[model samples]
Target: MIILAATPIGNLGDASRRLVEALANAEVIAAEDTRTASSLLRALGVDNRPRMIALHEHNEVERAAELVELAREQDVLVLTDAGMPAISDPGFPLVQAAAAADVTVTAIPGPSAVLTALALSGLPTDRFTFEGFVPRKSRVPALSKLAREERTMVFFESPHRIAESLDDMATAFGGDRPAAVCRELTKLHEEIRRGPLAELAEWATGGVRGEIVVVVGGAAAASLDLPTAIAQVLALVEGGARLKEAATEVADATGLGRRELYEGALKERGR
Candidate 1:
């Protein structure tokens, strides 16, 4: 059997009893970081030392079949440095392999940074999307597409890129869009800042540290008329945005169809 266990994101006390038992009894442990896995065992004071193997992104694909085969014979434990495995982390490949081989896979649920940040974000959690990390390139266009997203959006970002990411989000989603920046969650210096995207960008410029989770409130339902949306798109095109890009941006913000907006802009251009 393959056991997917969740480790504490930060607080050690968050470790569940089932995770500890699994760690104590598993024959083979496939960890994202062997050093971290060893440390976790020490932290939990587990006496049974299992054979530990590294199963990180660089090697997970190659090692997945081997690990799944081991699980078929005995319990093989999967873990990450923090949070559940395969959540924007290593472990998915192994899980997929296990499923393909008809190996039983089960999870020992515990702490999660995604859920932690969302709960503390003060945003509408009823509907939310978890986008693990923001891409380094073409981030502007990516965020531009979600400018009109009504469901709250959650994202993980490194400290170095948080400021730039926030700035781009503000530009794409509007400066006044509501957002929260969660830092070092469940740690000593944990902080949660709630404000408009513009304000968060300004704050980030000063400096940021620790693991970061950003939650942005989605765009409200569009109330503008089709003529108004088309006009908006035309204005964007006049300002040098491509017709397609202009239509997409306007349509996102106004809940209009990009095709209709583009056609309307073309008609207006002909006038």
Candidate 2:
């Protein structure tokens, strides 16, 4: 069996009893960083020293098969530096390999920076999406794709680029889009800055620090007549989106019936 364990994002006290027990008894561990895993064990006062395999983004693809074979013989504990493995971290390939090998895979649920930030974000949590880390470059194009996203969006970002990211978000999502920047979550200097994307962008100009999670509220429904909505759908379709996808996108934003928009676009295209 392969066990995926979640570590504390910031606060040590957030580490669950199950995680501690797993670390204490783990025989072979697949860790994103063996050194960090060792530090966590030492901090948790887990005396048992497990054999740590360095499983990181660079080597995970090559190491996954080897780890899967070993898991057939012994329980392998997977850990990232923080949070759960395979969550925008290493371990996805390992899990895929394990699933293909019919090896039993399970997880010990615990703290997550994404959920923590979202819960504290004060945005509509009923519907949300975790978009992982923002692209270092091409952010405008990347974020433009989500311009009409109707679910609260969550993202991880480095402090150095937070300002640029927020600015780009303002451009893509509008300066007045409500957002929350959760910094150094659950840590000593934990800060949750909430305001419009433009304001946050300005605040970040002076520099921000530590682990950051940005949550932006979803787009409000736009008021548009069917003809206008259909034209937008056709534009997206011309830009390489599938007809159905384009219709759905526009429909979601304009609160139009998807089938009606799709049929109208099809009729307009046939004209």
**Which candidate leads the pack in lDDT?**
2
- Model 1 Cα displacement at 154 (Å)? 0.7
Where's the lowest-lDDT run of ten residues in candidate 2? Answer: 223-232
lDDT, candidate 2, 64-175, per-residue tens: 9999999999999999999989999999999999999999999999999999999999999999999999998767657756877889999999999999999988866777
- If scored against the real structure, what TM-score would every candidate get? 0.86, 0.84
> Which residue pairs show backbone clashes in model 1?
none
| Model 2, TM vs. native | 0.84
Tell me how many clashing residue pairs each candidate has: 0, 0
Measured with C-alpha atoms, the lDDT of residue 79 in candidate 2 is: 95
Please write out the lDDT profile of model 1 over residues 159-226, one tens digit for every residue: 99999999977766777789999998999899999999999999999999999999999877854567
Off by over 4 Å in 1: 223-271
